[model samples]
Target chain A: MEQRKATIRTACVEALPLAIAIAAYGLSYGVLATQVDFNALTAVLMSVLVFSGSAQLVAVAMLAGGAGLTSVLLTVVLLNLRNLLYGAALADGLGPAKKWTSLLAFGITDEPFVLASSRFQKVGPDPLYFAVVAGIFYIAWIFSSLTGALIGDHLDPQKFGLDLAFPVTFAALLVPGLKGKPVIGTALAAVLMALCLEWFKPGNELTIIITGLLAPLVGLFMHRRSDHG
Target chain B: MVNQWILIGVLAVATYVSRVLGLTVMAGRELNPAVRLYFNYVPTAIIVALIVKQIFIPSGGHLVLSLPVLAACLAGALAILLFKKFLPSVVAGVVVGLLVRYFL
Candidate 1:
C-alpha cells in the first residue's frame, strides 16, 4: 500500500508539468473551438469524450477554415495515426487494467504517452501511475476547455485576433518538438506543399489531407537516407 | 450544430478504434518501423499544413497572405524556442499578432 502511494505521488509530480501544458493548450482549444461556433458545452464535452488534443485543436482550426465534415474527419484521422503507435507502445504498461483498457485507451494521446512510457520503463507496468497522470491531464483539459470557451464566448474573434490564435497556439505547441532531421524535413515539406496547393487552388478542402499524407513521405525518405548514410 | 455532433461522434469512434486496435490486437507485435516513423511524422506534417493553411487564407478566390498570422506564429515559435514556456509563448504570439493586425 505504501509502495502504491509512492507511485501515485511520483506520477502526480511528474505529470504536473505536462498537465499544465495540456491545460494551456486545452484553454487555447476551448477558445478556438468557440471561434468555430462550438458552445461551451460542446467544447468541453469534446474534451471529455475525444481527449485527443491534436485532433481536437486541428479539427476546430479546420472548421474555422470552412472545412466540411468529411474533410475534417479525414484530417483528424491523419492526426490520430500517432495514437496507434502510442497505444501499441503503452499496451504493456496498461496491461493490468484488463477490461478497463477501454477507458484508459481514451487517454492514448501524446503527452500522457510520453509520461506513461517513461514511468513504465522506470517502474514496470504501473497502471495506477498511468491513470494518475491521465487523470490530472483529463481534469486539466476538461476545465480549461470550459474556461476558455466561456472566455471566448464574450470576446470578438477578429478584434482580439482570436483567429490568429489558432496558428500561433499551434506554433507554441509544435515548435518545441521540431528536432531531428526527419521531423524538420517533414515540417518544411509540409509548408512548401501546402503553399503550392493553396496557390493552385486557394481554400481547397483537400489541401490539408493531401499535404498531411504527402509531407511525411519526405520525412520517411530523409529517415531512410540517414539510415543508409 | 448537428454536423458538429456528428464530427465529434465520428472522431470519438475513430480515435478509440485506432487506440484499442493497437492495445488489444497488436499488443505483442512490433509494427513495421517505417509505418511507425510515418505515424510519428504525421502530426508535424499536419500541424505545419494547418499553420500554412491559416497563414495563407483564401479570399475572393485568391490567396491572401495574412501577415499578422505569420508574424504571430513566428513570434510564438521564437518565444517557445527561447523560453521553453507554454502560456508565455502563447501570450507573446497573441500580443505580437494583435499589434501586427492593428498597426501593419
Candidate 2:
C-alpha cells in the first residue's frame, strides 16, 4: 500500500508539468471549438471523449474552414494513425496490466506515451505509474477545456481575436516538433502541396486529405537516404 | 446537435480502436522501418497542411493570403521558437495578429 502511494505521488509530481501544458492547449482547443459553433457542452464533451489534442484541434479547424463531415472524419483518421505506433511501442510496458491495459489504452496519446515510455525504459513496466500520469493529464485536459469553452461562450470571437487562435495554436503546436531534416522536409512538402491544391481551387476540400497522404512520403524518402549515407 | 453527437461518437470509436489495436493486435510485432517512418511523419505533414489551409484563406473562387493569419502564424512560430512554450506563444501570435488587423 505504501509502495503504491509512493508511486502515485511520484507520478503526480512528474506529470504535473505536462498536465499544465495539456491544460493550456485544451483551453485553446475549447475556445477554437466554440469559434466553429461548438457550444460549451459539446466542446467539453469532445475533450472528454476524443481526448486527443491534434485530432480535436484539427477537426475544429477543418470544420471552421468549411470542411464537410467526411473530410473532417478522414483528417481525424489520418491524425490518429500515429497512435498505432505509440500503442505498439507501449504494449510491452503496459502488458503487465492485464485487462486494465484496455482502459489504460485510452490515454495513449503523445504526452502520455512520451512519459510512460521513458518510465518503462528506466524501471520496466509500471502500469500504476502510467495510470497516475494519464489520470492527471486527463483531469487537466477535461477541466481546462470546460473552462475555456465557458469563457469563449461569452466573448465575441472576432472582437477578441479568438478567430486567430486556431492558426496560432496550430503554429505553436507545430513549431516545437520541427526537428530533423526528414520531418522538416515533410512539413515543407505538405505546405507546397496544400498551396497548390488550394490555388487550383480555393477552399478545395481535397487539399488536406491529399496533402496528408502524399507529403509524408517525402519524409520517408529523406529518412531512408539519411540511413544509407 | 445530432451531427455533433454523431461526429463525437465516431471519433471516439475510431480513436479508441486505433489505441487498442496497437496494444493488442500489433503488440510485440516489429513494424517495418519504412512504415514506421511514414507513420512518424504523418503528424508533421497533417499539421503543416492544416496550418497552410489557415494561412491561405479562400475568397471569391480564388485564394488570397490573409496577412493577419500569416502574421499570427509567424509570430506564434517565433514565440514558440524563442520561449519554447505553448500558451504564451499562442497569445503573442493572437495579439500581434489583432494589432495588424486593427492597424491595417
Candidate 3:
C-alpha cells in the first residue's frame, strides 16, 4: 500500500510538467475546434473521447478547410499509425495490469508513452505509474480544451509562447536520455530524416511515421557494430 | 448534427482500436533481443522528430525555421544540462522563447 502511494506520488510529480505542455496544445485545439463550427460542448466532448493532440488538431483544421469525412478519417488514420509503435513498445510494461491494460490502452499516446517507457526502462514494468501519468494528462487535456473553447479566439497560444511548450518539454525529456553512440546516432539520424522529409514537402504527413520506422535502424546498426568492435 | 456525432463515434472507435491492438498483440509475446533493443530506441527517434517538426514550420509549402522555437529548444536543452531538472528547464525555455517572440 505504501509502495503504491509512493509510486502514485512520483508519477504525479513527473507527469505534471508534461501535463502543462499537453494543456497548452489542448487550449489551441479548443480554439481551433470552435472556429470550425464546433460548440464548446462538442469540442470538449472530442477531447474527452479522442484525447489525441495531433489528430484532434489536424481533424479540426481539415474540417475548417472543408475536407470531407472520408478524407478526415483517412488522414487521422495515417497520423495515428505511430500509436501502434508506441502501444507495442509499451505493451510489456503495461502487461502486468492484466485486464486493466485494455482500459489503460486508451491513454497510449506520445507524451504518456515517453514518460512511461522511460520509467519502465529504469525500474521495469509499473502500470500504476503509467495510469497515474495518463490520468493527469487526460484531466489536463479536457479542462484546457473547455477553457479554450469558452474563451474562443481570445486566447492566442503563440502570443504567450504556449506553442513553445511542446518542443521545449520534449527537449527537456529527451536531452537526459541521450547517452552513448547508438542513442545519439539514432537522434541525429531522426533529425536528418525528418528535415529531409519536411524539406521535400513541407508538413508532409509521412514525416513522423517514416522517421519513426526507419531511424531506429541506425541505432540498431550502431549497437551491433559496437558490440562486435 | 447527427453527422458530427457519427463522425466522432467513428473516430473514437478507430483511435481506440489502434491503441488497443498493439498492446494486445505484443504483450504476451517474447520479442527478440534485437527487436527489443530497436523498440527501446524508437521513442528517442520519435520525440526528436516531433521537436524538429515544431521547430520548422511549413510556410507556403516550404519549411521556414522558427527562431523562437529553436531558441526555446536550445534554452530548454541547456537548462536541463545545467540544472539537471525538468520543470525549471521548461519554464526557462518558455520564458526565453517568449522574450524572443516579443523583442526580436
Q: Which is the leading candidate under DockQ?
A: 2
> RMSD of candidate 1 to the true fold?
1.3
State fnat for each of the candidate structures.
Answer: 0.76, 0.84, 0.69
Better of 1 and 2 by lDDT: 2
Candidate with the greatest TM-score versus the true structure: 2
Cα-based lDDT at residue A138, candidate 1: 92
Each prediction's DockQ? 0.76, 0.79, 0.44
lDDT of 2 by residue, B4-104 (tens): 89888888988999999989888899899888889888888888888898888888888889899999999999999999989889999999999999999
- Predicted structure 2: lDDT: 0.91
What is the per-residue lDDT of model 1 for residues A12-111, given as tens digits with 9 covering 90 to 100? 8998988888888888999999998999998988998898888899889888888898888898888888777888889999999988888898778888
Ranking by DockQ: 2, 1, 3
Model 2 agreement with the true structure over A1-229: per-residue lDDT tens digits: 9988998998999999999999999999888888888899999999999999888999988888888888888888888888999999999899889999999999999999999999899989999999999999999999999999998899998898998998999899988888999999999999999999989988888898999899999998998899999
Which model is ahead, 1 or 3, in terms of lDDT?
1
RMSD of each: 1.3, 1.2, 6.0
Task: List the TM-score for candidate 1's chain B.
Answer: 0.93
Model 2 sits at a Cα RMSD from the real structure of: 1.2
Interface RMSD in angstroms for candidate 2: 1.3
Tens-place lDDT per residue, model 3, A73-176, is 76567556667778888988998999999999999998999999999999999999999999999999999999878876465666656567667767887899
**Candidate 2: residue A61 lDDT (0-100):** 88
